[model samples]
Target: MAFDAVVTDLDGTVVRADGTVSAATLQAAHALSAAGVPLLAATARTPTGVAALTTLAPHLAFAVCCSGAVGWVPGAPEPAWCELLPRAEVADLVAFLTRELPTVALAAYDSRRWRMTATYQAMRPNTHKGPITVVEAAALPEAEACTLVLGHPDRTPEQLVAALIEGGFDPTRLGLHRAGRRFVEVTAAPIDKASGVLRALRVVGADPARTIAFGDMPIDTTMFAVVGRSVAMAGAPPEVLAAATDHTASVEDDGFARALTALL
Candidate 1:
C-alpha cells in the first residue's frame, strides 16, 4: 500500500556498513518531503546519533531518538518536546547498576549531545561535563548532545543485559538490549521503537494503517507489528523476517529507499 508517511530504523536497516545512507535513499527522502509527505527517523540510537541526519531531508520532522526518550525536532532549532526518564531516576538507576553491576556502562541524554558515564568508547573520543557533575560519570557541560549511549564494548551487551536483570533491576521499569556486539542499552519503560513511533505519529495525527516502517532487529519488531505496512531488512534476524509483513533489500541495497519509493 502507498503510505502517507514513513519511519525508519538506523543501523542495519537504513545505514550501510560504511555508516552512510545510500544516495538513492536520500533522494527518496527528498522526494517524499517535496511531495509533502512526512518522513521520520526512528531508531534505538539516541538523538545525538541521529542529529546529523536531521539535515538529510528539508522536509523531515521530529526524530524518534534514544528509542523515543526525545521527540527531537531539529527543524525548531530547539527541541519541541521530549519524554525522559527522570534525572533522579536515571541517577538512581546508575547508582544501582554501579553497585550491583559495577562494570555495566550507563549514560543519559538531555537532548543535544551524547554523554558517557560508564565505558562507551564507540563514540568519537571526546569529553564534556554533564548535568550531575559527578566524577564517576563523564559529564558534558553545554553538552547539547541528542543521544545517550551506554554499554560495555569489551563484552557483548547480552552478557550485561543478563547481568543487569539478575542484579535486581525490574523489567517493568525499563527495557534492555544490545544495539550490536559493540553496544547495549537500557531505557525507560515503553522505549521500544514501535511504541515511540506510534506516540509521535499520534501527535501529528498520522494513521497507523497509512504509515510504513523499515527496520532490521528485534527492537524494531514492536514497530513492525503495529504499523499497517512494515518491511524487514533482508539481513534482519530470522525472527524479524518471520514477523515482517513484507521483506526488502539489505541496507546496502537501499531497502528503505526501495520500500518508500514503492509506497510513493
Candidate 2:
C-alpha cells in the first residue's frame, strides 16, 4: 500500500538505546524523503528533545512534540504552537496527586523551559538532560505548562495512572497519559498525538487515511486510531501491540527501517 506521509514516535520506535539512528534507518528515511513521503515525529519529547534528534531531524518534515502540546519545524527557532495546561487545573491536579501519592515527584514543561520540584530534580539521573529550573513543589502550579510530568520511585507509569483514576483525580480539560515506564504526563485536553499528526498533515495537505504511524507506547494509541496504518514495535507492551494495525521488529534491530521498507 502507498502512503503519503510517515509519523513516528522517537524513543523506542526509531532511536536506539544509545540515542542514535542506525545507518539503515537513515537510508530508509532518505528513501521516504526522495519518494516525497515526509517523515514526521509525534512524541512526548519537548522541542529541545526533538532538536537533540539531529540525526533524524533532517528527514522529518515536521515534529509534534511534548506529546502533541507543541508543534515544531525541524530547524525553526520557535514552535508552530504550544498548548498549555491551565494554571488553575495544574494547581488542582498537583494538590490532588500529592495528597493521593505523597511520594510523587512533579515537573512542568512550559514549552521553552521546565519548572520542577527539587525532589524530581534529585530523582532524575545525570544522563537525563533538559533545560530545567528547580523550584519548590508549591511553585509548580504557578506556571502554565505544556506538559506536566508526575513520577513516583516505586510505581510504573501505568500503575500511577491507574492509581490516579482510582483516587478520583479529575482529568477534565486535561490529557493524562503515561510516558516511558516511570512518568505520567499531563497536557491540555483534546491535544494529543492524533491532533498533532493532523496538524502536521494539514501543513503538507496529507490525508490521515494515507498516513502511516509508528509507535510503542499507550499514548501512541490515539495516533494509531487516526492513521491509515499503525505499526507497533515488537518490544511494545501487550496492550500497545494489540492496538496497532501492524507489527515490526524491535528498535534494537532497526524495526522502523524494516517496517518502512515493507510498507512503502
C-alpha lDDT (0 to 100) for residue 77 of candidate 2 = 88
Best by lDDT: 2
User: Candidate 1 lDDT, tens digit per residue, 1-264?
Assistant: 367678888778777786677788888877877777688877765445665544463546657766666677645565545665545555555666666655656555666544565354334243232233223552432334333445654556666667767767666776675565456656666676776788888866788889888888877887888889888999788888988889998889887888776655
Which digits, one per residue and each the tens of the lDDT, describe model 2 over residues 2-100? 998999999988988888889999899999988888889999888788778788888989999988999999889889999988888888888887877
Kindly report which residue stretches of model 1 are placed more than 4 angstroms away from their true locations once superposed.
100-102, 122-135, 138-148, 262-264
The reply for model 2, stretches above 4 Å from the true place, is: 126-130
Whole-model Cα lDDT of every candidate shown, in order: 0.67, 0.86
Q: What is the TM-score of candidate 2?
A: 0.95
User: What does the lDDT come to for candidate 1?
Assistant: 0.67
Clash number for model 1? Answer: 17
Clash pairs detected, candidate 2: none
Listing every candidate in turn, what is its Cα RMSD in Å to the true structure after a full C-alpha superposition? Answer: 3.9, 1.5
